[model samples]
Target: MKSSYFTTLIQLLLLGAKNPIKLSTSDLAISIDKTQQTASMHLLFLEKNNMIARYKIDGDDVIQISASGLKYLLSVNQKIQSAFDDNSSTLVTGKVFSGLGEGAYYISLSGYKKQFISKLGYEPYPGTLNLKLSSNLHKQFIENLSNVDGIIIEGFTDKKRTYGNVICYPSIIDSNIQGSVILIERTHHDSSVVELISPTFLRKKLKLKDGDEVKVNISV
Candidate 1:
């Protein structure tokens, strides 16, 4: 929508509003798909005339559209419709890519492998899950891993930016440590797909191998 109309929509939504949505100039620009300078400029004019008042909270500035502004904006509809139509695709414009290598563990969010295994409308973010391994051993690592349950292994990213389906870690032994146990959860689809999550990275720093013969302890 044109600037006048889009600004009007903002006026309508916020008109006479006691406490309106807290938004930044950038946010206004993105919501309406207009230039940041334009949104800020219009908002500035509204504020100067007391048609809208600005408030500050939590280190953020908030604006409440005035009743007078609402009356002026009611004539605009296309801008309002466009604003409501935006979805996630419009919010986060950047994505990442990651891979795993020898004797290293980390969490990553790059690549699109997760999409192949999840249901539609299922957001893969915000799930806190991970893999952990620690060991100083350099040999016999393969023999030690036989006891871990449901372990899997797979190459995270290839030279061509591709990945293999995840498989049981025990099923694929690159090499084993003689002095430590290598714990693995790489079998889970995303468990070992790069250090895509914090828990998995922590596991790597812990230095635990799959399964090494060692003492056991559990304390809350």
Candidate 2:
């Protein structure tokens, strides 16, 4: 996607009263300082790719970013942020948290486990270690990690149901263990809460407990 597209998306998100904003090509063009034709073309592409929802209300264009679109924009934002933090390695600090007991089951699924081994270099232990970000900076870094384009665990479907895609970032847990921070495509946790997967149980190896502060060092 072009920078203009992101600019327009940010414009809409900031200026619109609701999730979607209603506007014409000329209106969008004026907002982004682009030609009307260019604005229309970008809007069309966004609509076709399921990024923005577009329709005609008596000949006017109504546009809003879909769920996928929001996710993509988030990834783009993270990339831009990473560019500014281009110094040494990034260290994210957080506190340990208990999850809903779903991580193990999902990680154990054959569809995901197979790829975890091949792409992540280890078959993750059945469970994931959950951490809650302790600071605004750490939370921002976590979001950037998701956008870094590390090993991708693609979503899959079997006889039961469809699973969402997951993005991983190679990370050093507690300054020793090698693992990856796993961001599930569909997660019940908020952005501040991060999940990590490793070949061994992190809780036991690191002697972690709820509220314990932990740091993950990630190389961008």
How many pairs collide in each candidate, listed in order?
32, 0
| Ten residues in sequence with the least summed lDDT for candidate 1 | 87-96
Alpha-carbon runs more than 4 Å astray in model 2 = 1-88
Provide TM-scores for the models. Answer: 0.28, 0.60
lDDT of 2 by residue, 23-133 (tens): 888988888889999988888877777778887677777887788888987897898898777644678888998988999999999999999999978989899999989
All candidates' lDDT scores?
A: 0.40, 0.83
How high is the lDDT of residue 207 in model 2? 88
> For residues 1-220, what per-residue lDDT tens digits would candidate 1 score against the true structure?
3467545455537433445767788877776677999888777777776567778889887777767655555544556666666421111011122223422222123433243123112222222222222332312332333444422334466466544432222111112211111233333322222122221232244353533222211000
* Candidate 1 RMSD computed on C-alpha atoms after optimal superposition onto the true structure: 20.2
Deviation (Å) of 55 in candidate 2: 68
Which predicted model would earn the best lDDT? Answer: 2
Tell me the TM-score of model 1.
Answer: 0.28
